[model samples]
Target: MLNFFKKKAALVWAKKHVLKSGEFKKNSVKNQEALLLSLVKTAEKTLFGREHDFESIRSVKEFQDRVPVADYEDLKPYIERVKKGQANILWTETPEYFAKTSGTTSGSKYIPISKEGMPFQIAGAQSALFHYIAQKNNADFVNGKMIFLQGSPEMEEVFGIKTGRLSGIVAHHIPGYLQKNRLPSWNTNIMEDWEAKVEKIIEETEHENMTLISGIPPWLIMYFEKLTEKHGKKIKQLFPNLQLLVTGGVNYEPYRDKMNDLLGGKVDIIQTFPASEGFFAFQDDYTKEGLLLLTDHGIFYEFIPLEEYGKPEARRLTLKDVELNKDYALILSTNSGLWAYSIGDVVRFTGKDPYRILVSGRTKHFTSAFGEHVIAFEVEEAMKATVEKNAAQITEFHLAPQVNPTEGLPYHEWLIEFEKEPENLELFRSELDEQLRARNTYYDDLITGNILQQLHITPLKKNAFHEYAKSQGKLGGQNKTPRLANDRKIADLLEIYKL
Candidate 1:
């Protein structure tokens, strides 16, 4: 009787979400503009607002003119003030929680999640699930257990506010009704060691009717591997009811083949764009290739063309000014008090009418070591194509420029952990090089000019990436090994695991 009611309620909620989504789609531009004005007005008295003269900003252009695009370092002083229990430093009120995230340049970043803005974070994720339910017209998953493999929910008091991983903070906000169906009990979740936690999770959930599983792709792959090792059965055989796989943090295409193989069958996969800054987009249509950007989720967005990302005269474009298929740096001004903040992500528009986007790469995470800029999207696409063509399954891969190889011209080095090595290694390498060269004209030019040699692949031992992550003390919880790097920091560390 309880399961029946839950399904009915879920269906009802999904229907309402469809209606609401339609309205938002039709009014995306209007909603964004209004959201910006509201955010400006709400933060008018705050320190950042006063400094930027937010009170006088009446239009998007005016706001753009008044407020310069900023990265985390630019706002660190204000965040520091907030950490000391200061109110109205970044927002109108003190933050309820700080979503702590590991940063590249900055050591640790604590993104403020105000009481007013917190609901939107939860809503964006909920809406993603509701969108799936509506499109598939299937709410039967609600009757079965769902597991969100995430950070430990344990939090620490930084000043007077709670501080923890973004996933951990979000774990605290799971809707009450779904609590009963959520897996891996509290004690299991708070376990500090990722390996131990995964073991506990398997023990708790291996026999349950797991209908949905959610986590970053690499971590989820790890969990799947552990399950198969213990039971000696495919994931689908162990959990026949499993219906959905929700993923985010990194691109899913590279890992899709291996994940599907481990699952033993097909399952619906939903990719989301989530960060400590906010939940920006999610796969709303299973048939579609891009995620539906959440326009009404209390975030006002701006885009800087990838070519002009760091230029002083770079145009900050509104939704109306964006063009399809052009990569742009995603910028945000949210109700949480972030203004003209660069989230360091590069995105490309896939649709204009309803505003769907694909996360292409990160602004800082490209390899330009040889004047041939290679982004994460290009490499992942190249790897995906090559892997499919060669009948290979990769566990994980990383790319870095081999600028000073001992006995050759400078070249790109591909460190790959293959679950199934290609039959012909040299042919696989040449084909992969061709695929990447076809996508990146700059790389092709460099190769043709004899400036750089073809990329070299270093086959890695099994669980190489896992060992690398463990070595860095970032084995789990939203941490992902970068696909490519401008520097050889990660590549040098991964050398010892070479097969």
Candidate 2:
């Protein structure tokens, strides 16, 4: 009876909140400007606010003229002060906690989690579920356990401000009612050993009526593999009522086949674009091609055209001025007190009627080393098409440009850890090479003109990336294998495990 009531409540919440997201998009530009003004007004007395002259800024143009787009390097001083218990540096007063990010350039970064920004994060989380529920008409989601493969919630404090993995921080915030139906209790969640945690999670959830599962795509694959290995049955047999999958942090196109195959059937997969900095976007409609940007979530957004991103005097546009299909590097200022911050992500607008977008790639995560300039989306699409053509499954992969003449010619090198190796390796390579050439004219021009060598493939030993990530102390919790390294750092690391 209680479970039925909970399901009904979830349905009702879905209707109300999904409608709210719609309304939020309808007034995206105005709401975004208002959010920026409100944020500026609230922080008008802070050091950053004062330096940027937030008090005099009454419009987006004024704000743009006053503040330059900044990355983590530019804001490290203020973040350092915040970590040392300083108040009103980046944010007004001290933050309630900090979301520690695993940055490859640095060890980790403590991003402020202001009390004012918490509700927006929470709302985004709620809306993720609500959008999924509304799309699939999830009438019984609350009746069964929803297993979220999360990280350790045991937080460490720096000058009285608690910090841990971003996913762990979010895990600790899951509402009380849902907690009752959540799998992998605190004991397993805080185990600190990922393999052991998986074992314990299988034991704990093996008998439960699991309706939903959420995690990064690779981790979800790991859990499914473990479940099949231990139970001697498919995922559908293990949990007959499993309804849907919610995943984020990496593109799912590459793993989509294997994930559904392990389930013995097709399952609805909802994508989300949640980051430590903010919950930026979520899949709001089944009919929509891109994610609905959560415009009202205390975030003010700006976009830099990808072509002119690094140019000193390039232009920046707000939500109202963006065009469809052009890749734009995203910049944001939030109530969390990150001003004119470039989070390093790039996205493209897909639907302007409701401000829907697709996360195209990262600002630094691309291959332009010979002017081939291939992005993550193109690579992902190429890989997907190649795998489907070859009938294969991928476990993990990392890509880097091989520029030195040691190999006789410059080419893109792929280090792939496959779940099942292809029947004909050379043909798989050929298909991928052909597909990429078909997709990107610049890449094709290089290959066709014989300016660059053909795609060089190196099939890796099992768990190559997992071991590499472990070596880097970045093993789990939404941390992905860097898809494209700026140079040979990751490629050099993977050379040791070449098959």
Candidate 3:
């Protein structure tokens, strides 16, 4: 009786979600403009707002003109003030929580989650699930156990505000209705050691009706591997009711083949674009290739063309000015008091009418070692094509330039952990190189000019990436291996695990 009621309620909520989303989609532009004004008005009395003269800003153009685009470093001082129990430094009120994230140059970043902005983050995730339920017209999954493999929910006090990983903070906000169905217990979640946590999770959930599983692809793959090892069966065989896989934080395409192989059956996937800064988009249509951008959310967005990124003359474009298929640096001015903040993500518009986007890559997470400027999208697409053609399955892969190789010209080096290696390794390498070259003209030019040689592939031992992550003390909880790097920091470390 309880399960029946839960499924009916879930279907009702899904129907309402679809209707609400349709209304927002039709008026996205107006919603964006109004949101910007509201954010500006709300923060007008705060330190950042006063400094930028937000009181006089009446239009999007005016706001853009008044506040320059900023990275984390630019706002570090303001965030520092907030950490020391300051109120109204950036937003109107003191932050309810700080979503701590690992940063490259800045060490640790503390992204403020405003009282007003945090609910939308939770709602975005709920809406993603609801969207799926609406499309499938089935709510059976709601009656079964669902696991979100995530960070430790344990938090520390930073002044009066709670501070923890974004995943951890979000874990605290799981809806009351879903609490009974969610697993693996709070004690299991709070375990800091990822390996131990996964073991506990396996013990707790092994016999349950795990109808939905959510996490980043790599970590979820780890969980799946552990489950299979324990049960001596494929994931689908163990949990026949498993219906959905929710993923985010990295591209899912690269991990698709391996994940499918692990599951050993069909399961729908929903990709989301989530960060400490905000929840931006999620896959609303299972048949569609792009995520539906949340226009009515607390965020107001700007797009800077990828080619013009970091240049003085870069144009900051609104939704109306954006063109389909062009890569742009995603910028945000949000109700959380972030103004013209460069989130460091690059996205491309797949549709205009309802505004769907694909996260292409990170602005900094690319290889430009030889002026090739290869982004994650290009490499992932290349790898996808190569793997499909070669009937290969990869566990994980990373690319870095071999600037001072022992043997020949410096070339791009791919360290790949293969679940199923291609029959002909050399042919696979050449085909991957060809696919990448076809996508990136600069790489093709370099190879044609003999300025650089074809990319080299290094087969890695099993659990190579796992070992790498463990070595870095980033074994789980939103940590992802860098796909491409200009330097050999990760590549050099990966040498020990080479097959």
Error of 3 at 419 (Å): 0.7
lDDT of 2 by residue, 303-364 (tens): 99988897889899988789998889999898888998999888999998898899888988
- Model 3 RMSD vs true structure: 1.0
* For every candidate, C-alpha RMSD to the true structure in Å: 1.0, 1.7, 1.0
Q: What is the C-alpha local distance difference test score of candidate 3?
A: 0.93
Model 3 is weakest, by summed lDDT over 10 consecutive residues, at 143-152
- Per-residue CA lDDT of model 3 for 216-328, tens digit only, reads 99888999999888878999999999999999999899999999989999998999998999999999987777999999889999999999999988999999999999899
Best by lDDT: 3
Alpha-carbon shift of residue 327 in model 2 (angstroms): 1.6
**Alpha carbon lDDT of each predicted model:** 0.92, 0.85, 0.93
Cand. 2 TM to true fold: 0.96
lDDT of 1 at 160: 92
Candidate 1 local accuracy as lDDT?
0.92
